[model samples]
Target: MKMLKEKIQKEGIVLSDTVLKVDTFLNHQIDPQLMQEIGKEFAARFKDAGITKIVTIESSGIAPALMTGLILDVPVIFARKRKSLTLSDNLLTATVYSFTKQESNDISVSKDMLHEEDVVLLIDDFLANGQALKGLNDLVKQSGAQVAGAGIVIEKGFQTGGKEIRANGLRVESLAIVESLVNGGVVFAEESVNK
Candidate 1:
């Protein structure tokens, strides 16, 4: 997590008071070594939860989720934003609005992949508005699977997402929590907490 924070500080771009772009290493171009470490951290955090499946939204969340699945020795299921022709008739769906993209997407997962007895861990590249994570959590609930927790690569702690999700009784583990993006500066929660 310290390495992740260092990466964010070095490479992340604070676009606005609310937007911190991490496309250099996370959103667009990925660092495999960092991702592997992230997977190890997530696996360690949720190892005792009896997780049977790792769930996440398609695109950005796939990398971290896949890595976690690999480390945990569990299958990863990603919710598709756009349904393909081969998708099954029975699908679990939810609407997730991206605060960064400023749009809503209907994410779906095949009902066959998740089971009632499975414990699911949700993973995502970022947790901003909590919509994506919530949507994935809904899909898991629809399948009658228990939610073990969520693993977020970066969380905008200045936003309501992390607080709301935690209030909803979901345990959230974020590698880097940006407390502020004020004046094009990234202030981490840990730094602020210590102050």
Candidate 2:
């Protein structure tokens, strides 16, 4: 988590008074070493939760999800942002709204990927409005699977997303929580995963 904080300080951009852009190393262009460490940190944070499976929203969340799955030696299941014909005929699907993109994506997962006997841990790159997590959480509920918690790489503390999710009584852990973004600078929360 210390390394992630340092990377954000070095490369994360404050796009607006509320949005933190981490595309340089997180969304678009990836830093493999940073990603590996991120996976390790998630594993360490959620190690005691009895995680039988790892879940995430597609596109952006795939990297960290896969990494965490590898480190934890659990199966990774991602909710697809778009449905593909290639996806098996039998699947579980849910709709989630993206606050940043200002749109909704119907995410889908094959039926065989998850089971009622499993406990799920959800992971994502960012937590803004909690809508995405809501949808993924909905999917888990529909499958009759237990949700262990949610793992986030960066949380916009100014926004109510992370707070609302926590209010829902889910254990949510963020590696970095940004208190605010002002005049192209990032203000971090007093409490971080490092703390």
Candidate 3:
């Protein structure tokens, strides 16, 4: 986690008070080593959660989620942003609004991938508005699967996302929590004893 914080400080771009772009090493151009470490950390944290499957949104969330899945030896399922011709029937769907993209996407997953007896862990690159995680959670619930919680790569602590998700009884483990992105400076949240 210290390495991730340092990496963000060194390479993350602050576009606004609310936007911290980490495409250099996270979402776009990924650092495989960092992602492996992240996966290890998440696996260690959720080792006892009885997670049967890892769920995430397509594209940005896939890398970290795949890494975590590999570490945990679990299957990873990504919710498709668009319902393809092959993914047409018996799909569990939810609407996710991306504040960064300024649009809503209908995400879907095949019903066969999830079941009532499974326990799911949600993963994502960033937690800003909580929409994507919420949508993922909804899909899991629709299948009657238990949600173990969420693992986020970066969380904007200044935003309501993390707080709201935690309040909803979902355990949120965020690696790098940005407290502020003001004046083009990235301020990270102080590490808590509980974390």
TM-score of model number 3: 0.97
C-alpha root-mean-square deviation, each candidate: 1.9, 1.6, 1.0
Model 2 per-residue lDDT at 194: 25
For every model shown, the clashing-pair count is 0, 0, 0
Would you list the rank order by TM-score, best first? 3, 1, 2
Candidate 2's TM-score: 0.94
True lDDT of residue 39, candidate 1? 93
lDDT of candidate 2 over 158-189, digit per residue (tens): 88888788878998889888887988888778
Better of 1 and 2 by TM-score: 1
> Candidate 1's residue-wise lDDT over 7-101, tens digit each?
99999988889988889888899998999999999999899999999999878888999999999999999899978999977899999887667
- Best candidate (score: TM-score): 3
lDDT of each: 0.89, 0.86, 0.91
Query: How close is every model to the real structure, measured as TM-score?
Result: 0.96, 0.94, 0.97
Best-performing candidate as measured by lDDT: 3
lDDT tens string, model 3, 108-194? 999999999999999999998899989999988999999999999999898898899899999999998888899999988888812
| Count: clashes, candidate 3 | 0
